[model samples]
Target: MPSKADADAAPPLPEPLRVPVADSHTHLDMQSGTVEEGLAKAASVGVTTVVQVGCDIRGSRWAAETAAAYEGVWATVALHPNEAPRIVHGDPDGWSRQGARQGGGDAALDDALAEIDRLAALPQVRGVGETGLDYFRTGPEGKEAQEKSFRAHIEMAKRHGKALVIHDRDAHNDVLRILKEEGAPERTVFHCYSGDAEMARICAENGYFMSFAGNVTFKNAQPLRDALAVAPLELVLVETDAPYLTPAPYRGRPNAPYLIPLTLRAMAEVKGVSEDVLATAVSANTARAFGY
Candidate 1:
């Protein structure tokens, strides 16, 4: 027999599903011409907002425009590390910052920072990232240089009081270390969260937000499902990270924020919570974190 306290701790059965959601970390800019079509699909499926991410200067500009052009769209700006080399070796004019200081002293990293500044100044810009360490998939680079770039984004986020959408790959320890050393802003989010249950605890302890993508719904995601129990509802967010992680029923289709409902339904089931309650939390937390 269970103790009364143990029995009491178990939540009653979750309420029946109802209500809509917002995809917290989408790539609407990546979706391109489908902005109108995507918005309509999202509304149809109950996704209220889509937070588009910026991967480079072009994407950054498109992000701002997408936010303004659509009713329920917001934007996040940053230079993802996979594209780091481009900022260095690509078009010289592509560097949006002033005076065009090249390499070392200012580092090509500043080009991204410049885009962040420009975009953040816009009312449509809501958050600061798609940034953070990505060593798992990326090849070797000078750690010092990578650290410099990562720390710069954190400092900028702190300065702007904007939330960060970190992309921590196999570099979990390094990512955690940077977040701590740089004193990550009060509201940090792990986009496409891939860490295990222990990382969930760390996220909870730090008040960090976890934005789950379609991967969480995969058949082999038992660890992710287990981690779900460890995080509070308020700390949980849902995203499509679209054109990727299309979720079960819609897997293989080119994903968009519109498909967020599938992911939301799955997450609600995992948490043993009502879809409405979960949707509300995802939307509210997403808006607050992105200042939408």
Candidate 2:
């Protein structure tokens, strides 16, 4: 986790992108500044839109409300994979307890998911997720709950005819298998896509969108860049995943929507396309994936 000083020290904005694009995933509720300030900063740098992603019920509600209040924003609602285990058992560490609704056990988890279901139906809520498996943080004991929640969220997205945003970490096979078994929504996105070239090919074959983030610019992310190289422009999207995954030269610093240009430029290079061309494709792809 980043320190308070690191979170507060914003990076200098890069040159604006010539073609405007959307930051397909972000967490404004976790960032330092007000929503208005973040949007304004992003708009000035050619990031004209963003998707406010929620990790739990409280964040989901905040996301929906913020999206409703702001034209430039859309919301995706879900309980994070780690949050599922916590809701089912308990959050002894309280990592995700901020503004979180109280309760524990099966019934409490169901109630929380029900609220997410209701939020998914909202006009401003364009997606259902940030949900999926996270084997890294969650131990074997929590796998069942995570998969259950993931399947439920998948159904919710399909029922509501919205995009399904997946957060897969060290659980790629399971994520892919579950998506295959559950029959993914028409518009499914791998948020901050962490797969390799082979996985990128699979996603293309299945018509899933791959959303790349600042981490793609890291020195050790050649595999991610390789994935980008093979990913079709139409199936590619870009995001900040703000307050995390800050791009190169600014790694360990706070990320924001305004830094999207840095990542987009990096992606354009990997794809061997002009920034404008890639941005145009991503802008169009985002609207299609999230339905505006």
Candidate 3:
């Protein structure tokens, strides 16, 4: 959920860029503004493409529908790691977050994954993720279910020939282990990349994409910048992960796709390259990752 302090309005849009870029992962559905407003704001600032990511079954369906209705937008379908435990245990509170009913048990998990599989076949759905382990939000009780769901999504992405967008938080080793064991999809991205330079080296060796988000702009995020520095330019991507992880100088304020430039500029500085050069590289990387 978004913080209360940053819920009212969006920040001013940054100056438009000559080179266009794509936001590799975002949850427009969870943001403060309407979908059209969000899209317009992004376009006005030259963030021409967006990949709307879903956190659960209902959200995945909505993402696919939104992609079908809008241009310059794509969808990624998945049952988030935190959301997986709720499905396995039939937890009412967790189900409520996704607007799903309780009592369905393991069958519900199967049904949800089946829907995700169906959605993966859509032309507008280009990735399978925001799916990976979340040790911070989900504890030991939920880890097994999360792993099962992660492996399932991995297979789905491979079968559909789409990118795999991972959401790893404090479970980097496990995430890598699972991917190796399951044979990762052709294009794998670590969304909101939360790893060190060594981890970046590991990803680079494996031909995976590392997507840096607004959090990378924080003064305390030196490790993230370090990771960006070591990442191969061809294997790098950028995203807003909007409505959360707003960039510096606007850390407590709302974030939108329009604000992507703030993070991108920060990334360019860290990588010791001009923003335009980094932007062009990131845009091409995103296109290849999602096949857009």
Total clashing pairs for each candidate: 0, 0, 0
Ranking by TM-score: 3, 2, 1
Residue pairs with backbone atoms closer than 3 Å in model 1 (clashes): none
Top TM-score prediction, candidate number: 3
- TM-score winner between candidates 2 and 3: 3
Q: Which stretches of candidate 1 lie over 4 Å from their true place?
A: 1-17, 89-106
Alpha carbon lDDT at 185, candidate 1? 92
- Model 3 C-alpha lDDT per residue in residues 111-180, reported as the tens digit of each score: 7788899999999999999899999999999998899899999999999999999999999999999999
Name the 10 consecutive residues with the lowest summed lDDT in model 2. 92-101
Tens-place lDDT digits, model 2, residues 1-292: 7677875688998999889999999999989878999999999999999999999888899999999999899999999999988887767454236433465677667877888999999999999999999999999999998999999999999999999999999999999999999999999999999999999999999999999999999999999999999999999999989899999888988899999999999999999999999999999999999998
lDDT, residue 280, candidate 3: 95
What are the RMSDs of all candidates, in order?
A: 9.6, 2.6, 2.6
Runs of candidate 3 exceeding 4 Å displacement: 1-8, 96-104
| Poorly placed runs, candidate 2 (over 4 Å) | 1-8, 92-103
Q: Tell me the TM-score of each prediction against the true structure.
A: 0.86, 0.95, 0.95
Top lDDT: which candidate number?
2
Question: Compared with the true structure, what per-residue lDDT tens digits does model 1 show for residues 36-98?
Answer: 877776777677678889876678778888788878888888777655544554435555342
- Native-referenced Cα lDDT, model 2: 0.93
